[model samples]
Target chain A: MALSTSSAITLNINGEKHTLPVDHRTTLLDALREHLDLTGTKKGCDQGQCGACTVLIDGRRAVSCLQLAIASEGRVITTIEGVADGERLHPVQQAFLDLDGYQCGYCTPGQICSAIAMIEEHAAGWPSAATADVRPEAGAPPLTADEIRERMSGNLCRCGAYVSIVQAVAQAAEAEAAQTPTTARQFSGPSGPGDLAHPAGTTDAEMTA
Target chain B: MREFGYQRVFDVPGAVARLGADPDARYLGGGTNLVDLMKAGVERPALLIDVRELPLDGIETTDDGGLRIGATVTNSDLAAHPEVRRRYPALAQAVLAGASGQLRNMATVGGNLLQRTRCGYFADLAKPCNKRVPGSGCPAIEGEHHNHAILGASEHCVAIHPSDMGVALAAFDAVISYETADGPGELPLAEFYLPVGDTPHLETALPSGALITGVTLPPTPVAAVSRYRKVRERASYAFAIGSIAAALDVQDGVVREVRLALGAVASRPWRAQEAERVLTGGPASADAFAAAADAELAAAKTLPHNGYKVTLMRNLVVAMLTELTEEAAR
Candidate 1:
């Protein structure tokens, strides 16, 4: 007997239950954009090469194009549409708007989603290839331009808006850090102690002034 | 994409049983490569058993202070694990040096180790690839052959393994744990990947219906100070043209112990055992490092387009060893 190829799966996306009948071959990106009408998550490369289809699956950023809709049934998915608090824009979105972090804005949703998780990963002391030290004792590396570029390398901007994107990500990271002040989470950065919380090219004096 | 049945399995035995029942069912993990292959029409499995939710997603310590990493453990979690970062720095570095953060968050350890080559010919259905379709023909041998293999390749195939984590695992002597139809089994990382003699299609020695459960990393003290360096076209998000994974244990200016492996050079991770043999008990100097690298790469047979890999591998070995030596001094 042939098994059923399509099923009605309820996906927990953006704190709402989305029950949709989809073919087994339908990717999560297609389901969100076409079926559920959540076009905030863009699809650049149907393959995994481009990160324009990035979303947060269970609090971690992942490319949705490679994920099948049926497989994402029980997972908690967060898209760019759910990033804001009703009308209040997320800090990442606000930073991007303020700093012109995008040119064509095709990759904005993915860039914002990736930057949001990256800040949290950095706060949790996850080291990147650009980090000077990978030891636990090193705490978190200072969020430098090089570090932002490395962490957000997945989401590509075809319009060459990397300079502003890097600046916007840095600003959002600092804004989030200011809201939640933790002591042990201090970064024993490569630079002096004065540049501990501040990102590279932005000084403590500038932040205060 | 073709229609396929998707089933999510919760246990290892059930997964194995289901796969054994179907003749063309594939075990999907992260779907980073498999889904792409399906989209490209390279793979068309009738049923895809989703093993991501299986109970094989833990990284625990063994009685011998070694680490047993579950197959479903994501690359991001593996790279961020405290024990992995402190004990097996090279493994973590290798994982971090690979694909972007999004891919790593979804990619599993077993999937990364089992991923296929990124050869254009292999992915192109129109082109003839010996690995993709045995006995067809290898177009890459004469066209765009610069990134082909430099060692352990035949006229049949010349595609290099596109895994940075496997290089470090090869250096540390990792063991692959799997559950077969008969019973559970283990294969050392060295023997897990079969040699590319005549058949490039048969990549691993894994049984027909075996399911990889986890990877057991033996306790090696030298691993604490190891490093993985990949030379890619870009600084990140690109496959390696040449890479090295090295761990050096120097005592009083002499090479007490060393572990070495080269990536993107052959069908499998090229463990530099000959280099280790030459570096043992020798002075930890630049000259000694260079000589040891040459010794390991002496038997390398390279194609006309890939001859530069021999030099690239040699320089990478020396440079990584020298950097480790300097760090050991301080």
Candidate 2:
């Protein structure tokens, strides 16, 4: 057996840049878990069938297993690790905990990451298969049960916590809609390219309240 | 996964040149399909030319009133485009029906077009699959073939092209544009896929090192009335058992034009030209629709477990056509 050749690449993970040598065949999921040690993003299925490796690439939800680490250079990648503000939990994470959105907790990271992007997508007036009357005049589609299920169909929980997961997403959406300034401020602070600094000292209790 | 060299091509010429230079090099789009195949050990490319960053992600209107969708356009963007939703509803619906939202966001048009079969035998490394290795013998012909092809399958392979988008593209008579070492050229989507003859390994009509640039859909009024109907075991995230992409243009109780295509029933997207011919200039009635569907599926040669697909395809065609005709009447 011979050692595989490696390539030097810089990956910006969880609001920090790390330069590492990775094999050419290393997927973004492997690079995160094996190389960078960000095990928050679980690998449910090495194939793209399962969404356990879900992450935000340039603010869009993508399956990390399907993305090559070399092809993902220069993009902003937000994992489950980056969803919190210092010691503070993101609203979605708080909602998940408050609602007990997981039983086994294996698929929780992907569910949370996917739900965050799903909320932003709906708020931006994107429609899902469950969305009837997709015209703008129809207004922002409500986060109904059907809408939640359809939008989050990618992330599967074998433990059958789907009902609780949907409830958590709805709660988070409702909280975000309430425009709680402190909670909103954490997410609104510099989440684009070249913005690596995390917000300081926001707490989980403050976000939940 | 086997160790491989990677190259990122910035231009079409560079991509063609690199691919032409290396016989074992495969072009990478979103890696949603190729990576999975590589992991399965079914594909062992020595070099991968990453074409995701190429300047071919645009979705623009052609000068002739058609639409030119770049090959690299993500499935999510293509499905959600306002023009697609308004004009080509079936195409949009077909794309949405195929994959999850996250997968769609990462899958590109080119990658989706070149997606391999979901046949269990083809994906298994230990199994004998002619599609994986020519003349290795196909276990699917007698093995668990419940989801195998019902039409255009030879003795060597019974695999089906698992793309819902391909079926819709076939119905729309879309053209595939490609660039080769010589120059650029285009072929109708109907002529793009090769029949599953003795040589099951040869899938597409693309020349070696030819890079698919985009797909051009000609303007057709039938698009406004089209619908894509897929029947599967589950409500979501399941492959279609049998699907139909139908567009009916009925005027004054007469079917002025109709386009039909079947998915998950053939090795490639089966364009129902015979059905279209039967529906054109015919009465807009359930009887006529059923007759057209029967004519198209008349040649379907089904295996033991997949005999249901023939009936499923017939019902899907009739039901979609009936719905479109009634909508046009209203």
Candidate 3:
């Protein structure tokens, strides 16, 4: 069904189309947790200062708390609840679990989602300011402790799980690179890199299949 | 307390229109800077006009070999642009040195330019601040002026402009474009900001109901050899205690044209014009650099809590200019 702007906006949350009426001031974080009951995305500061509310929009990691519901209309969103399959966790999620990447786990959802997006960003040859050289060779540059800290500076764990969280992101990036083909994960938008487009909500049956 | 209004505009005209229509409205760019202030109760705008969707996100080269940067351009984009990185390394370096990756992704150039004073009293509305509430009196002047201004300070207020990008742009002789309810006008970056000369509340010279459209850079030969040096309490995500953005054009070991500016030491982006005058036609030497920096700091009025800024800023200015001159020699 075609979605109108003024009426209830449809969101492609974790590949499922969820339509709900929302005020223009409502944040994506508030909408997910308060409206749809997708509480996996935590709200740390609710002002975008903390990355505890991080999620992926169109495959790039973004702070959901800062985004207005009207602005996120028809965008492809991936949250913590959608990261794992029916019974299996994503390799990053499993690695975080194995490495004890978090304590208290309040910031785990954001960390995991941000880590997944970070891996994709590095794979696409996007270099961080700390990236030693703009262009590393075809082989993946091992995410050193320093590189991990710099890349994940946005995600703060009051519980001090940084050392292990960095380890988990690095481990996941390395493991994921060894499995998925580079072409399979590249993000293609409506036109190009920063273009914005409204995608008609996909049916629930097609998404789940 | 939780109730607020949000409106997204598609163009600069729309944003200005909304803002003019309601005096209680505030323009929201990336929301990295303003949202934090709102949550902290530092800001209380009744309406938020979202300018993120505005068609002002381009970074392009202007005619006559200069650069024109849109106000809504992200900090990350400004830092990573090849032209900006290669030509204006100091600006690129300063932008990269500020905030973290996530913040850089979400901070807009306009909001960065318009960022309020980072005074502790100003941030906490509970405390008294001349900037936050004019005539409320400044507590930092006698309390903890460690992070306060040492240069261009008035008896009324001495809060500093806490933007790394602004300092670099001032040294590079950039210009700010503004579109108001009437029309458009452009002002050199150095003149865009007003000092705390009694009226501490009035910051930028942007006309009432005017929106910053973009910032323009005048291409300078010194840009290739420029560098930004910043010293802070921490390695990242902290405001600079002392920072220098220096660009030098040297010919045969003699300084020809030098543009120098100091950050975190003054009420505005403190351009060291006197320093530049002294450095011009002088050989690039430690003695020359030190004398020039000293000349600029001579006018600085340091309070008891901020006397350290005089020495730190002096040393920083000398070091930054020295390093840029050395880079040109290389």
Q: Highest DockQ, which number?
A: 1
On residues B74-192, what C-alpha lDDT tens digit does candidate 1 reach at each position?
88888877788788888888999999999999899999989999989999999998888888999988898899898888888999999999999999999999997799999999999
DockQ of all models, two decimals each: 0.46, 0.32, 0.18
CAPRI classification of candidate 2: acceptable
Per-residue lDDT tens digits for candidate 2, residues A1-209, read 33234689998887899999988889999999999999999999889877999999988899999899987887889999999999999999999999999999999999999999877666555556666544333444567777788889999999999988988988897777666433333331111122212112223433233
Colliding pairs, model 2: none
Instruction: Score every model by TM-score.
Output: 0.95, 0.92, 0.86
Candidate 2 deviant stretches above 4 angstroms: A1-4, A132-141, A178-209
Better of 2 and 3 by lDDT: 2
By lDDT, the candidates rank as: 1, 2, 3
Please say which candidate is ahead in DockQ: 1 or 3.
Answer: 1
Candidate number with greatest TM-score: 1
Which of the two, 1 or 2, has more DockQ? Answer: 1
Per residue, candidate 3 scores C-alpha lDDT tens digits across B1-330 of 334666778877778888998787788887776766876787777777878778888888888888999999888768756577667878877886777666776689999999988888888878888888888998888887888898888888888889999989999999999888788999898888887887899998998878898999987878777878778886656789989898888889899899898999877888999999998999888999999988999998988888998899888877777777777778
Give lDDT per model, in order: 0.89, 0.85, 0.79
**Candidate 2's residue-wise lDDT over B13-130, tens digit each?**
9999989988888999988889999988888988899998899988888888789999998887787666676678888788878878888888999999999999998999988889
Candidate 3's TM-score reads 0.86
